[model samples]
Target: MESEQALESEAEQGERLGWWHHSHPTFAGITGFFAGMLFVTALPGAFAGLLRLLLDYETAEKLFPFVLLALALPIAMLVKRKTRRFAQFMFVGMVVTALVVLGVASLVLYFMVDA
Candidate 1:
């Protein structure tokens, strides 16, 4: 009975503090923040690149920012369903996305500087 009560109260505390995935609030918030950052930084550029390369579209870059909501909605829904899973997926996704974006950006910079 005592353990059950403690668990109940702990859950209540988490609810009060905006904890997700039944873990502490801070960790969830930090993961979500970085995930959002990755979405903003990489996803649009990725979409633009695909459109340009695969579809042979010249003006797709101008529309990349508009797809921000399209990219974010699925992740938001996944978080709503399961926070821990969201955090795990987002952690990996963010790292990969950031690396790709940075790698391309660096290559572009290198070419510009060399020229």
Candidate 2:
């Protein structure tokens, strides 16, 4: 009787803590958003750095267009029903981040040129 009671209590505790093991509902969206931001910012810089390390400037510049192939992964994710929601959030993040960066950059350039 004592052993059975202890086992039941453990099972109840496990059930209570099970949600801790699983991600929250927003986890996917938040993760996808940050991932998209990083993909836009860091991925290109890292890719360029790697290319420069391995090849000359002329060769790396010629090969840089190949980076567009990375778009296929997100396109594939968007096509799949299971990943569509995360992919959508990722796209939103990418577009917003890009717009903000470009807007600030252009504003700064305009001010500098005007001055």
Candidate 3:
């Protein structure tokens, strides 16, 4: 029985429900990086470790990463819907983290080869 204006206001309120809605974009991006680091990376790593402990180590090392990836999607979807533009920010964070790690690893390898 809500009017059109009531529905519009409800939509607006829904959009504004989360704390990140009014914050700066850079802060949101940082929030996403921390979120992705803890939620996406660290969490999965812990799960993999537990799986390795519970199951065969080599099999868990190989399979649990994909299992974590599959499990993370639902949680990420919930986060994306709840936060503003968070999925984009989180993906950026993940990619940047990956690139930085790869760069450091390659540099280490190059230095080792040089020495």
Candidate 4:
């Protein structure tokens, strides 16, 4: 038993594992979920900000539709076997986050208008 343990440790030391390999089982899910949230929230804001910085308001608004192109990256990830699981979690996170944000925004608007 001790000899086997020693061999296992030696083998582990011989090859370095990548960050993904060394991470916890839930790491991928958590990371993917947060990535999706950021995708929905920050990515658009950052894209819009970049556009506004480089172009006039009219041009920026016109080009806003192009942000949809980013969806292709997640679709590609879903098609790949290795990343499919992460992509699935990311999709769920995106939907949930969007729903929550929209719900809260509507509630705030309703109350503000009523009061």
Candidate 3 residue pairs in backbone clash = none
- Estimate, for each residue in 66-86, the C-alpha lDDT of model 2 and write its tens digit: 888888888899999988878
**Which parts of model 2 are misplaced by more than 4 Å?**
1-23
- Candidate number with greatest lDDT: 4
Q: Top model by TM-score, which number? A: 4
Can you write out model 1's per-residue Cα lDDT over 26-112, one digit (the tens) per residue? 665666757756775767768777777865454675655677566557455566656655555565666676787799999999999
* Residue 22, model 1: Cα distance from true site in angstroms: 4.2
Q: TM-score, each model?
A: 0.41, 0.81, 0.61, 0.82
Off by over 4 Å in 4: 1-23
* Ordered list by lDDT, greatest first: 4, 2, 3, 1
Task: Assess each prediction's global lDDT (C-alpha) against the native.
Answer: 0.69, 0.87, 0.71, 0.90
Error of 4 at 105 (Å): 0.3
User: Which order, best to worst by TM-score?
Assistant: 4, 2, 3, 1
Residue-level lDDT of model 4, residues 45-91, one tens digit each, is: 99999999999999999999999999998889999998887898899
Clashing pairs in 2: none
Cα deviation at 62, candidate 3, in Å, is 4.4
